[model samples]
Target: MKTKPNVLPAHNDCPQTTTTGNSRRRKAHRGIEMLSAMGWWSYAIIIVVCVLGMLFGLYIFGRSGSEASNLTQLATATQRAARTQAGFGTANLNTVLYNAGQIPNGWTYSSGTIYNQWNGTVTVTGKTSYFTITDTGIPSSECISIAQTLAAGGVANYLTVGGTKITPASDIATINTACGNANSSVNSTTKTIVMYVGALQ
Candidate 1:
C-alpha cells in the first residue's frame, strides 16, 4: 500500500508571534526617551541665550547714562566759568570809572590824578553836573567803543589792570587783541583800578 507520509503544509514552519504588541510598545518608549534628551538640551540653550541678552542690554544702558552725566557736568562747569569772568569784568569797569572821576564831577578837577572821593553832586558853570556812569564792562563791545569815542573827543585817557598798562586800541583788530588779555580789578594787588582822564581843551 503506497501510504503518503502524514505531511503538513510547507508554510507551517514559521515561528508564532505571541508578544508583538509588547515589542512595539518597547520601541515607542525608546523613541520617547531619545526625544526627551534632545528637548532638555534645546531648553538649556534657550535659557542661556536669554540670560546673555539681558546682561548685554544692562551694560549698554549703563554706559550711555554715564556718558550723558559727564557731558552735563562739563556744560555746568563752563557756564560757571563764564559767569565768574563776566562778574569780575563788571567790577573792574566800575572801579576804573570811579578813579577816573567820571562818576563825581571828575571834569571839575584840574589835576588828572585818580581819586576815590565820589560822594555827592557838584556844580560847574551854574549847572549841577551829575556823574552818569554806564554799567558796561569788559567782554562788552560797548566798553571798548565808549573808550575809543572818548579818546576821539579830545579826552585824554589812561587805563591799567593788574599793574599792566592797557594800551588803547587804534583799530578794530587791536580792540579784539587787547580785550582778550584784559584783567579785572580782582586781579590787582592794590584792589584799585587806575584810570585818569582829562579834557584836552
Candidate 2:
C-alpha cells in the first residue's frame, strides 16, 4: 500500500547535461602557442639593440675625454710661460727689458696696471725699480718669436728675438694659437703680441 514516484519524461522535463571531446578545442590552443613564440623573438631583438647602442655611446665619450685632456695640458703650458717673467738682456746690452707698466720685482707701480699700452715707456716704483722696454716697432710681420718667459700666471707675450722693442697686433691667427680663450692679440703687420704679464698685488 506505499506510494511510488513518477519516473517518466513528462514528470522530469529538465534537459540532460552534454559533454564535448577535447579535440573540438584544439584550434584555440594552437593560436595561443603561436602568439607566445612571436613575443619571445621580439623581446630578444630589443635587448640586443639596446646593448649595441650603449657600447657605441661609450666609444664616442672616450675619444672626447682624451682630446679634452690634451687641450688642457697645452693651455697650462701657455699660461705658465706668460707668468714667470724675468729680465731680458742680451750678452752685450746692459738695459734690461720688461713691460714698462708692470710691477717691478719687490716693488709696485701706481698706474692701476695696464696689459696693452702702445707707448714706448713704462712707470714703476720700488727699491730696485728700473724701466725696461724693447724696440717693438717692426718693418714686417715676419720678425717675431713665440716664447714664454714668465713664472706661472698668464700667457706670456712672445718676446722679439732681440729685446729691442715692444710689439702690437691687429689679427690673432698668424703666428700662434690662442691660449685657452685667454686675451691674446698681435701687431697688424709685424704679428707682434701686445699682451704682457705683470705682478697682480
The predictions' CA RMSDs to the true structure, in order, are: 22.7, 18.4
Per-residue lDDT of model 2, residues 1-201, tens digit only = 988987677635878655455555676688888899889989999999999999987765543343223223323332332223442211211111133222223222234431212222221222111112222322232232232222121332322323233334423342233221223244234323233322322
How many residue pairs clash in each candidate at the backbone level? 0, 23
What TM-score would every model get versus the actual structure? 0.30, 0.28
lDDT of 1: 0.37
Candidate 1 global TM-score:
0.30
Q: Which stretches of candidate 1 lie over 4 Å from their true place?
A: 1-23, 81-83, 86-201
* lDDT of the candidates, in the order given: 0.37, 0.34
TM-score, candidate number 2: 0.28
Which candidate number would show the highest TM-score if scored against the true structure? 1
Best by lDDT: 1
